[model samples]
Target: MSPFLPLATVIGCGVVYHVAQKASGAVSPWPVLTIAYGAAFAVALFMLGLGWWGRGDAVRWPAARDCVASLALGLAAFGIEAGFFFVYRSGWPLSSAQVITNLSVTAVLAVTGIMVFGEHLTGARAVGLALAAGGATLIARG
Candidate 1:
């Protein structure tokens, strides 16, 4: 199977997941977050077990510096998760919030790709970016 298939699957699942989450109404964000993370951890553990028990490549631990970096990344993740919880509590519409946040993130990434990664944007990519920007502007106004 091509790589795009899995990527598309993940993106589709993410959309459905967010929609389901928003439809669930205003529950306690902390408990919800806890459960979500717990489930994710469980999945990771299951994968690890499979790799260990079945494949016999149990654990390749990271280096000390990598561990420290991961710790910092975990902190950043927690911060963003907490911020999203607060934003959800603020009664923002899910669609609007998702669109605005995604567009802003995409814009930042596009700029970063060009500047830091030295990526060349093709004509098609430029057109797509322009369309995305225009759509974001309309969404922001609405």
Candidate 2:
């Protein structure tokens, strides 16, 4: 698969996700998330089945560390969903909210990717990061 495919998917979903989240902000976050996760679970099961059938991969018990990592990921997903829901409900415009959150996440993850994952950060990328931070600050204040 082309690398851009997944990036485009995330970008498209993010656009709709924010609109849906803002629309549903009147409802409690937990209930909204419960339904969202339920749907995600259903889709996950279907995808697992496809993997089993197509890739000859059978579902098996994950290792303890993998399980812990998966559980942590779930917790983080909830935090992202609920945190944004509350922030939107609290009157943060989606424009600023997404910009602020995405830039901050990008910056932090860039550091972690370099330090923990041994990813290289080029000089040009550093300049881009600085520009992103400055843009985020302007959007947040404007």
Candidate 3:
């Protein structure tokens, strides 16, 4: 697998999750998320059992500090997923919500890069970011 495969998989999962959440909104968000997470955890455990999570023949564990950080990150991720499921059930259009959410996230990251990371954006990237922000605004208004 290529290095970008995981990133693509994550994006695809997000899209599918939004669609499923919209379709399953008649049901409770908690139940839906719980089932989804349970399934995902099962799959992950299965992969681990099959020895699919490490380099060729090595299984590596992180440091305690890293494990703690990862746990916090996982908690935050679950919170976001739960919140999004609820928002999906709240009658938000999938297209609008996804677009706005993605664009807003991109905008925040771009701003953070500029402010915190001191990353410089070229003229073209700046224009693209502006267009993206405008499109997200239009989507949210729709």
Candidate 4:
């Protein structure tokens, strides 16, 4: 499969996610999170069904132990969304909020990638990250 479709889906959904969170700033985050997660669950299930049919294969649901990662992912997703919602509620402009969060998370993950994953910080990657950092600084300053 071409990466273009997957990347477009991610970018599109990210836009919608931020807009929805910002628009629903007046509501309780928990309830909103509940609804959003429920919808996400439904969508995941639907996608799984579609993939199974498309491939003409039996469902390959993960074992209980294998689902542990998904459980952790759910918790992390909740925390991320709630944190963003609170940030928006605290008067963070939509433009800078995601920019700051993404850049900060990228920096942390880059460190983790290097230290824990033993991934090399190649010169090209370093320059890209530096440029991102500089852009984030400008965004935050505004």
Number of the predicted model whose TM-score against the real structure is largest: 4
lDDT of 4 by residue, 1-142 (tens): 6769779989999999999888894667888888888998898888788785366577777888879987998888889989998999999989999999999899899999999999999999999999999999899889
**Stretch of 10 with least lDDT, candidate 3:** 50-59
Judged by lDDT against the true structure, how good is candidate 3? 0.80
- lDDT by residue for model 3 (1-142), tens: 6889899999998878777777774566677667888998999777776665554455467799999998998898788787777777677888898787778788898889999999998899999989988888887887
Error of 3 at 64 (Å): 2.5
Worst 10 residues of 4 by lDDT: 52-61
| Candidate 1 displacement at residue 136 in angstroms | 1.6
Q: In model 2, which residue pairs have backbone atoms overlapping below 3 Å?
A: none
Q: Which whole-number lDDT from 0 to 100 does residue 122 have in model 3?
A: 88
What is the Å distance of residue 139 in model 3 from its true position? 2.2
- On the 0 to 100 scale, the lDDT of residue 106 in model 4 is 93
Ranking by TM-score: 4, 2, 3, 1
- Collision count of model 1: 0
**What is the alpha-carbon lDDT of model 4 when measured against the actual structure?**
0.88
Reference-based TM-score of each model: 0.75, 0.89, 0.82, 0.90
Judging by lDDT against the true structure, name the best candidate.
2
RMSD of each: 3.1, 2.0, 2.3, 1.8
Q: Which is the better candidate, 3 or 4, if ranked by lDDT? A: 4
